[model samples]
Target chain A: MKYLLFLGCVIPYRISSYEISARKVLEKLSIELVEMPEFNCCGLPLDPVNHELMLTLATRNLCLAEQKGLDIMTLCPGCAGTLRKVNKALREDKKLKELVNGFMQEIDLEFRGGIVKVKHLVQVLAEDVGFKRMREAIQNPLTGLKVAEHNGCHVLRPAKYVGFDDPENPVILKKLIELTGALCLDYMYETECCGAPIIGVNDKIPLHLTGEKLRNVKAVGAQALITVCPFCHMMFDLNQPRIERVLSEKFGVPVLHYTQLLGLAMGFSPDELGLEQLRVKASKILNLN
Target chain B: MKNHDSTKPNSDGGQANDRKKEFGRTEHKIVLKASDLDPKFKYKISKIPGAERIMLCFQCGTCTADCPIAKFSETYRPRKLMRMTQLGMKDRVLSSDVIWLCAACFTCIDHCPQGVEIANVLRALRNLAAKEGLMPVVFKELVSNIRNTGYAYRIPELRLKRRAEKELPPLPKANLEDISKLFNLTHLSKTLEKEERQDA
Candidate 1:
């Protein structure tokens, strides 16, 4: 139950709350996370700019994890998706492996993909930490709280690459939400992109997409929106007010990382889970005094 | 959207005052001259991996129909782009601002009956655009950041301090020597240097 925690750039920079709560929840479940050492960006950010750069960088990270012989558990889906895609590609395609290794060899590394595995935190929770053990570990269940999920694009998408759940209708997050004893609500476009990736290019379209989701989430009377990616969390939580102002609609939806909800179910206090750091105040809906 | 002053990375255009200048540099006309069509353009794209199915796209419209960006954007149609690429409208497809709007959700990939993988083809097109040194400034900053710090963004100093305060292990320092080796071997730094000279 050990993994090298891959904290991509976003979690460390803008979304520390996710890291805080994820660490708390994983520790309670007895999943030991070793800090990944001397790794570069997972190569997603530069993918569109250059595919080779992405493949090479992602393979290099995989090699580092392979050297340690521990699977990678990432808080960010983008990191998990990129690493997994490259790992699979390099493993199956000899030519691609040689192309990536041509670059890896210069850096004194090799891409031996069969040795390591990359799993998103949700996958680790859903697959590795089975529900029966998790049910037994739950000291308190988040009964009566209403939350909906926004499983960001990368984790379940491009099904051929990182196939953990149904991409069209993701149920892993909903299942995990139910494990917390909170009522999981369904909202329109539940399995849609959060539009975080394109925010760097066209900010308005992303706001419109996120604003529409927020409007729909509010329409369904959800108390909070649960997300698994830091980028999705930013779009829904940190940018909630902005979305409201631009769309001329009010949606005070408190977005929580799925880990935070599970941490609460594990009886961890609000302060321990970094609930205070959320932009939209969640204490009232969460019934925290 | 012009009056909206924003310091965010993706606001109005990443690099200050460059959106108008960089994107859509080529003006596309509705009435196209035959010379605009590069007959071999589709072949050039299909040769690239992830875009091997570019010629197979039958314009099912499923990609644009399901694209979230296409819903809000007036111009970004993945189906139209596929047609344009196949029709050999290379310059028009390459220089269009709409191409960059895709969020790469892979919704197009999952739903396409032709196995066209529209998102991957879009990425391949974007890669070609990048080869011509036509890149957004945010990517330039990311390349520079990874080149300098081994991370995508230049993570702040205080955030590093806060990690220790919270009892988390200090953020791992990237091996710059190894990263630099990749950068040079891949010739990304050289490409970036050329881009910077053009930006200057």
Candidate 2:
């Protein structure tokens, strides 16, 4: 299956490993990913400040994917949520579609709305790749590793729009984790927000929230935390040291993008999946040490 | 105006002075004025996206109770904001720093029995706050970052060298012309321009 990969701003610049491992894993599964250089920010950052403008910007990206007659697949939950919401809004409301198209006229783009679907990578893996296929692709099963799943808010929130799984009780990510032969350890705050959305506004609150989740995961004895969104990965992975320092606790839980975990099980080395780039080392979990 | 005093005499016929002494406060009365309410504020908020249900809230504290941020910070309460918006206390709702504290997690919206989109209502309030130049400095910096570069955060040089070392493909540049045009067409540019002029 061919899809347009929308690498929203964060992955390309900050979290290249998510992109690298995702590309390699999808390639192994024979899913062709076409890169769209014209894609801009998914308009999430603008949502609170300017609702109409945010819709217009998200619609522009949707229109770009429509031109290719391919579905849009995103690595970030924020991008997936924004694009999915706008796509649903424009498709369901004619007046709103007209209003957004008016703004799109300036950019020489018009969204046909329903022509394309925006799928988060988690959705693509759970549904398109299928558990049977993923299991078959695993060359080295992770037998004893324990993982905590961090399903960030946007990917499964406002249940009506996202509709991927149960918002309160999501299991797609957990099931994907199990496919790699790792134990998806159940923990408190599994469905809580990573507080990434408000990180820019207030450092203290988001850090507290992230620290709380980290503490819970660490308490459960999970070797690592698995995530799908780049922003969540940032909070759990990049800021892990800072989070530990702030909370005065040592949580040696390595954070891995789902693709990275899947890549390891699929016979890809730690270096190949960019595990070395992570701040919290995955040596123990990956058996690298 | 009506004064509802909790320090008033109880059904046992105790004196107001006795109740005041019991409570140890002289200003325990809530003063409600008809003129203090902004009847148009609800309609104003309804105009914002995802906040059409602002008036549908029945003062149910589900949003507040389900809020993760509220669990930690006493000042951040979604249910109270909804009530303030409904009462047309525009200045109180928009000026308070609590409005900026919402994490936009949507847990409140997901669990709201009344189906009030609490998070989106907060977003609408934030937009109104920004228009009135009440946004925090960090949020303003993020807006400027997007306005100029089409991304929230700029990629640093060290990260650029690391990307090169990893042999990752070069990051794509944003179409700033279209981004700027959209910002200009919307009220964001005007609000930000006003903020800039005020700063200058």
Chain A TM-score values for every predicted structure, listed in order: 0.98, 0.97
Error at B122, model 2, angstroms: 0.9
Full-model lDDT for every candidate: 0.85, 0.81
Every candidate's fraction of true contacts kept comes to: 0.80, 0.52
Q: Candidate 1: deviation at residue A184, Å? A: 0.4
Over the stretch A1-289, how does candidate 2's per-residue lDDT look in tens digits? Answer: 9999888878866898998899889999999988786756887887777778788889888998899999999888888889998999899999999998988998898888779999999889888878899889999988888889999888889896678899888988898899888999989978988777766655666777888998899899888899998998998889888888888988778899999999999999888898888988887776632
**How big is the positional error of residue A61 in model 2, measured in Å on the Cα after superposition?**
0.7
Docking quality level of the chain pair in candidate 2: acceptable
Q: Each candidate's TM vs. the true structure?
A: 0.94, 0.91
Summarize candidate 1's per-residue lDDT along A14-41 as a digit string, tens digits: 8999999999989989999998878699
